[model samples]
Target: MSSKLSDYDYPLPEALIAKRPLPRRDASRMMVLHRDSQTIEHRQFRDLKTFLRPGDLLVLNNTRVLAARRFSDDHGIEFLFLEKLGPARWKCLVKPGRKMRLSATAKIDNVPMHVEEILPDGERIVALAEDVDLYAHGSMPLPPYIGRESDPADDERYQTVFAQTPGALAAPTAGLHFTTEILSEIPHVFVTLHVGPGTFRPVHSETLAEHPMHAESFSISKEAAAKIDNAQRIVAVGT
Candidate 1:
C-alpha cells in the first residue's frame, strides 16, 4: 500500500523533543523499532556499540557547518550556504530578503562581502573580501529552531572530529551523538553532502511521495565506496 504523508505522522510531545545536548554526546536514549516482533526497545545510545560487529561500515556525512550569520550597525543578516558553484561563488539564502538588494554589499563582522547577484528565492551569489578565508570568518550556521545565538563551544561541538569539508549550513544532528570512543569501536567512512536549508523545510505536500527530497551535492571517493561495498552491513544513522 502507498503511504500518504499524513499516514507517517506520529504524535511527539513537546517535552520529548531535546532542546540541548546531553552532558555527554552518547547519553541520549535510543529507541529500536522491530517490525517482526512489533516491539520497541528502549536502550541507551552507548549501547549501540554492542549491536555492531567489527567489519560493519557506518557511513556519515562530514560536511561542517559554516557560520553564515552576519551583523551590521543597523541590520542583522543570516545566510546558509546551499552549494559551492565555483572557487569563490556559492548559492546561499539570505535573511531580510526585502531589505537586501541585488548586487549589494553586506558587511560580515566588518568584512566587506559583495553580492554578485541574487536568485529568485532571496538567494545570493556573494564574493568574500580578498585574502580572507570565508570558512574561517563564517560562524556556525545554527538552525532557526535553536532560537538562540551561536556560542563559542558550538565551533567544536557542532562539527565531527573527522570533519574536513566546510560547506554545510547545518550539522547532521544524528551524527552529533557519536563520540570518538564510539567511532573507534566501529568501522566507518565519512562522506560529504552540503546540506541546505531545504532539509528543514516543512512538508507541505499531502502525499509522502509527492514531497521531493532536496538535491544535495554529495561526494564519495572510490576508496570510501569500496569500503562500503566490502562491508558486511551498512548502518545509516540519520535521515
Candidate 2:
C-alpha cells in the first residue's frame, strides 16, 4: 500500500529474533499463508512434506557460505570478500575507508594482500599471492544485521545441508531450514549461485524495476537444466 521505502519498515524487537539456531536443523517453525482462503497457518518446517505434490520439482542453490571476513587490527580495517577476479585476486569490500588507500597492503592471518584498485562503488580489487588462500583462515562474513561476534558454531550453523561450492559470502538462509532427510525425500535438483555482496544490499528505488542490481555467478548442470525444462511445476527453494 505504500511506495516509500521508509513506510515499509516496522519495529523488530531484538528478542523476537533468534540469535542462535535450534539444536536440530529442521526444528524451526514455519509460517504458511494460504492465498485462496486468505488464511495463515503455523507449523514446523518438517510439515512441508504434506503440501508438496509428486510432480512438483524443487530446485535449490547449493552454494556454500565462505568464511570471507578478514580483519587487520594493525591497519584498522576489515576485508569482506565478494567474488574472485583471478587465481589469487578478489573483489572485496573494505571497512574504515579512510585507512585503506589505493595502494594499501596488509597481511591477513599473515597472508599478504594488497588493494590493487578501488572501484567507483568503493569496493577494492585485492590481490593476494598466487598460492595463498585467505578464506582458509578468515572468519565467516556474517551479515551486518547480526550483532555479535562470529564463533565456531557459525561455521556449522551458517552452512546449508547441501552446500557444494565455496564462494558465497552469506548462506542462502532459507536453505538452512531444510535438513538432509527433507531433501532426500523431495524431488530436487541443485544449481549453484554463489551469493555475492549484493545479497545484503537493500533496494533504494521506489519500485523494484528501478533498482540497480549487483552481479553474482551461477551454474546449472545439463541434467538439472533438462529436469527443470521438463518439470510440471517448479519451486525455487530458499531465495
Candidate 3:
C-alpha cells in the first residue's frame, strides 16, 4: 500500500518542542530503539557512549549553519538563502513565495537585490546590488518548529562542536547533542552535508511517493570513506 502524507504525521506537544538548547549540550533525552528485539530504552544523551562498542565506526556531518535569513525591505518579508549561485548571486526561498514577481527588486537588510530568475522548484535567483555584511544583520534561519526567534545564544549553541563549513541553512540537529567532552572519547570521521530548510518542509501531496525530496550537497573525504569502508558497523550521526 502507498503511504499517505497523514500516515507520516504525528502530534507533537508544543511544549516538547525546545525553543532553546538545554543548559548543557549533552543533557537532552535519548531514545534507543532495538530493531531485532522490538524493544525501546530511554536514557540521557550523555549515555550514548555506553551503547557503542570499542570498534564501532561513528560518522559525523560537520556542515555549519549560516546566518542566511534576512528581511526583504522594511516590511519584514523574509528571504532564506539556500545556496550561492555565483559571486554575489544566491538562490533563496522567499516567504509568501508568491509575493515575489518576475523582475522585481527587493532590499535585504539595505542590500538591494534583483530577482533574476525563479526556478521550477520555487527558489528564486537573486543578484546583489552591492556587498553586504549579512552576518551583521541576518539571523540564523532556524526551523519553523523552533517557535521562537533566533537569539544571541543560537549563534554558538545552534552549531555543532565539529562544524567547519558555513553553508547549511539548518543545523545537523543530531550532532547538536554532542559536547567537546563527549566527542573527545569517540573516534569519528567527518563528512559535510549542507542542510537546507526543506528538511522541515511538509509533504502536502497526498502520498509520500508523490512528494519530492529536496537535495542537499554533501562530500566525504577519501580518508573518511576508507575508514567507513573498513568499519564493521557504521553509525551515522545525523540526517
Cα deviation of 53, candidate 1, in Å:
4.3
Deviation in angstroms for 21 in model 3? Answer: 1.1
TM-score of each: 0.82, 0.91, 0.92
**Which pairs, if any, clash in model 2?**
none
The 10-residue segment of model 3 with minimum total lDDT is: 129-138
By summed lDDT, the worst window of 10 consecutive residues in model 1 runs over 129-138
Q: Which ten residues in a row have the lowest lDDT in candidate 2?
A: 128-137
Report model 1's TM-score to 2 decimal places: 0.82
Q: What is the lDDT of candidate 3?
A: 0.84
lDDT per residue (tens digit) for residues 30-114 in model 2 = 9999999999999999998888888999999999998998887474788887767788888888888777788888777666777
Clashing pairs in 3: none
Please give the CA lDDT of all the candidate structures: 0.74, 0.85, 0.84
Q: What ordering of candidates by lDDT runs from best to worst?
A: 2, 3, 1
Model 2 alpha-carbon miss at residue 195, Å: 0.7
Per-residue CA lDDT of model 1 for 20-126, tens digit only, reads 67778888898888789999999988899777776778999888777765454356766665666676576677777655677677765566777888875557888
Give the better candidate number (2 or 3) by lDDT: 2
| Candidate 3 C-alpha lDDT tens digits along 1-239 | 64876766688899888787889989899999989999999999999999999778889999988888878777656888777767788888887776776787888766788889999888899889876555566788778888888887888998998899888988898999998898889888999999876786877889888888888889999999999999888999975
